[model samples]
Target: MAELPIEIALDDERATQRLGQDLALALRPGDCLALRGDLGAGKSTLARALIRCIAADPGLEVPSPTFTLVQSYDLRIPIAHFDLYRIADPDELVELGLDEALGDGAVLIEWPEHAGDALPSGRILIEIDEGPEDSRKVRLNGPDQAMQRIRRSLAIRAFLGAAGHDDADRQFLQGDASTRTYEAVTTAGGERLILMDAPKRLIGPVLRDGKRYAQIAHVAEDIRPFVAIGSFLRDNGFRAPEILARDLDTGFLLLEDLGRGGILDDQGLPVTARWEAAIDCLVALHRTDVPRHITIQDGTAHTIPPFDREAMLIEVDLYLSWYLPHKLGAEPSPRLREKFHAGWNGLIDRLENASKSLVLRDFHSPNILWQADRAGIERIGLIDFQDAMIGPAAYDVASLVQDARVAVEPVLRDRLVARYEHARRRDPDFDPVPFREALAIMECQRATKILGIFVRLKKRDGKPGYLRHLPRIEAYLRRTLAHPVLHPLHDCYTEAGITPSES
Candidate 1:
C-alpha cells in the first residue's frame, strides 16, 4: 500500500495560477474551489482564469459580483463565482442565492465568507498567496479520501489519449453545517458517501478501539450492544449504506452517498408522498428482531450515565433553559425547577422501562431519506444514532410522528404510529388511549432534549439558526403535554416558566 507523494514546492505565481487554470479544465459537476487570500492577493485572478477555461466562452468576462453578490455562467460546465467581500453576514448568502450554486456545478468564488455555514464538505479549499514579484503560491485541500481513484483517473487519462468526460471542470456540493469538508471522489460512478464530524471530542477514543465507528470496517464486539439494531436493519431487506472505507485513527468515514435528492424536508414533493415512504421505513425498523444480546454492562452509552440518565437530564435542562426562558422571558424559581426535573425524570423512567428495544435516538425526518417513487423509503438511513441504546420501541416512532423541524399531519402521524405498533406485535393488547399517552410522553422527552441541543448548537457549537426550530419543537412539546397522560408533566413544565408555546 503506497501513499501518493504530495509535492511541496515554492512555485512562481505565474506557474501556480497557470496550474489552477489547468485544474479548472479538470472540473466537472460537483466540484468546488474555495479561494483563500487577503485583498488583492490573486484569489480573483485564479478564479477568473478557471472560469474562462471552464465556460469555453472566451466571451465570458469575469466581473467581480461585489454588489450583485454571485454571478452564474453557463460554461463548458456550469460555473458560479461568488464574492463575499461586501456580505458581512452568512444569512445574506441565502438571500444572494449562493445556496443554489454549491451543488449544481463548478463554483469559483472570489470571497466565500458569504457562503457562511452552507459550504459543502466536498469543496476544495484553495489557498492562494502572493509569492515573490509575479508569482503566487497555490495549495489544494480535499475532504474526500482524495482516493488514488481520482488521481489515478487523471493518470490513466494521461497515459491513454481517450476522453469521455473532461476532468477540467467540476461542480461542488455544500451543506448547511460547518463540518469543514471537501471531497475528491466522483459519485457519477454510483458510489455512496457520507461525511460525519466527531459530534464531541469524547468520540476520539472510541473510534480507535476497533468498533464500527463509521470510520472503519472494524467492529467492536465490546460495543456490540450499540450495533445490534444497525446490524439487524442491514440483515433485513432494509439497506444501510455499507461502510466503504474508514481511517479509525482519524475518525473519518467514507460512506455510500444516498444522493443529494434524499429528502428530510424538501418542499418540492407532496407530504403524502414523502411520509408514505417514511412510514414504511419506520415499520421496517420497528419490525426487525431486536437483539437480546444487548449488554447494559460496564462502559456503554446506555449504562444510565451521560448517554442515559445524565444525558437525558441534560436534555430536560434544555427545556428548562431555552424554551422556557424564551417563552417565559426568565427562568422559573428553584422550586418550580425541581418540579420539572422530578416529572421529567419520572417520564424517562416510564419510557426507559417500557419494552426496551433498539432505539435509534434521532430517527426522524432529517435523518430519513425518500429513496423511491412510492410508499416506504427505498433505503432508511440512521444518522445521529451514535447515542443509540436498547430502549423503548416507540422512541423512534415518537420522533417521526412529532417532528419539530416541520409539520407532520395528524392523519399521517396516527397512521404511522399504528403501523409501527402493528409491526412490533400483531395484537399485543392494543390500547389507543395508552398508546397516545405513551406517544405524548415520548414527544415531550424528545422536545426537552432538543431544546438543550438547539441551545447547545447556538451557545456552544456557534450555530444560531438551529434556534429557529426551538419554537416549533416547543409547540410539539405543548401538544404532547396537552394529552391526558402527560397533563401532570405538562403542568410541571408550565410551572417551570415553560410558556404555553404553540405555533
Candidate 2:
C-alpha cells in the first residue's frame, strides 16, 4: 500500500504542467490512477491528453465512460479508464468486468471517488483542485518507487466527491449451482436493483437453445418458470435477490446484488451448520410449486432434455479419457473400461428416481455465497442455477458434497444427505446405499463434465486457470468411491486403470 503522491503547484496547462506525452510514457503497465477534482476540474482534459499521448494518435479524444461507463483500449497493453462522475451506479462497475482487467495492466480511473472500493491498488491517485486563475493544485499519491516521478509529472490536486426491496422482481436464495453471480445493484436513481449475469451461451441458472442445462432461458416469455421459481422463493420468505431486467437477447440479467460472504468461503463454521443450511435451501425449492395453472406440463414440455443416463454416461466417459488416463498414467484394459461404463450407466438409471427434486444441477461450494449478517433463511445465497432441472434429490446433494472446486468435509456430506432425505416426501426410509451410490455416481458424473469443460475452456477459450481445480475433482472421485459403500465403483476405477493415486 504505497502512499498517494504529493502535490506540486502547477500553472495553467500552457504554463507549467506535466505534458500528457511524458505522462503517458511514465505510466507503464499495472498502474492504477485515482484522479480527484471539482466540477470543470480539468481531470478529463488531463486524461484525454494522456490517452492521446499513450495511444500516439494525435487527433483522437477518448470518449468518457460516463455514458458508456467504460472504454477499453487495445494498446500494447489493455488500458481501461473509468469516469464515475456520471456513472449511473456503483456496483455496475463489477458488471463491466473491470476486475478481470485489474491485473492485466494499467488502468486510468477518473472521478474515482464515485467508484469507491472498486479501485485496485499499486498505482497513482491524483487530486485536482480549481485554483486562482487558470492555475491548479494537483496532489498525487503513489508507491514510493513512482512518487518522485509522479510528482514531477502530473501535479496532484485535492477534490471531490443503497437499501431497498421491490417485489415485482423476484430473487432466489442462490446457494448452489449458480456461478460468477451478481449479488445486488444500485441504479443511478437510487433504486436498489438485484442483478444476476446469466448469459445463456455460457453457464448459469436458465439454459437456452438446446443447452438448457448449461445456459439460461434468455427470453422473458420463455423464462416464466425461472421467474416463477424466483417469485415463489421470494413470496415464501426465502432470501433471494430480485431480477430487475433481462436482456434476453444476450442472456444478461440486471438483478439485485447480494452482499459478500457465503457458505462457500466460510471455512471456520462447523460442518453441521453448513450441511443444515444447504439442505434447507434445496428443500425450500422442492416445496416451491409453479402456479397451479402453470402446470409442470408446460414447464415439462418445453424443458430441455433430462440429465438422463445417456447424458450422464456422455459426461462420465470424458473423465475416463481426459482425467483418468492422464492422472493414472495408463489406460484401463478393454474389459474394465466396458464394465466401468456399464456400471456407471446402471447407476444413472438408479439416479433417475431418487424421489425427483428440483435439482440445482451444479450445487457446490463455489456456487454458494454465504452471508454473515443473515439470521436464518437469508443465510446461503444460491447461484449458477440456469441449469436447474428435475433430477434425483441426491444429484444436487452430491454436487454440493462432492464439489469440483473445493472438497466438503465428509462429516458435512453425511449430515446433508440425512437432512435432505428427512425433507423428502417419498424417500423417508430411503437407503443410504442407493443415496451413497447416487452420490458416487454423480461425483463421477460431475468431475468428468467439469474436466471436459475445463479442458475446453483452456484449449478453446484460452482460459487455462480452470485446470488447477481438476485435481480436486480427481480427489473427490477417489474418496467417494473408496468407501465400502462404493467399493464396487472404486474397484471398477482401478480395474479400469483410473487414478494411479489409489485409495
Clashes of each: 38, 50
Once superposed on the true structure, which residue ranges of model 2 sit more than 4 Å away at CA? Answer: 1-185, 189-228, 235-237, 264-272, 287-305, 324-337, 371-376, 422-433, 483-492, 495-503
Candidate 2 lDDT, tens digit per residue, 315-354? 6665565555555677656876787777776666666655
Q: Relative to the unseen true structure, what is the C-alpha lDDT of residue 366 in candidate 1, on a scale of 0 to 100? A: 61
- Which one is best on TM-score? 1
- The TM-score obtained by model 1 is 0.60
lDDT by candidate, in order shown: 0.57, 0.59
TM-score of 2: 0.56
**How far out, in Å, is residue 303 in model 2?**
3.0
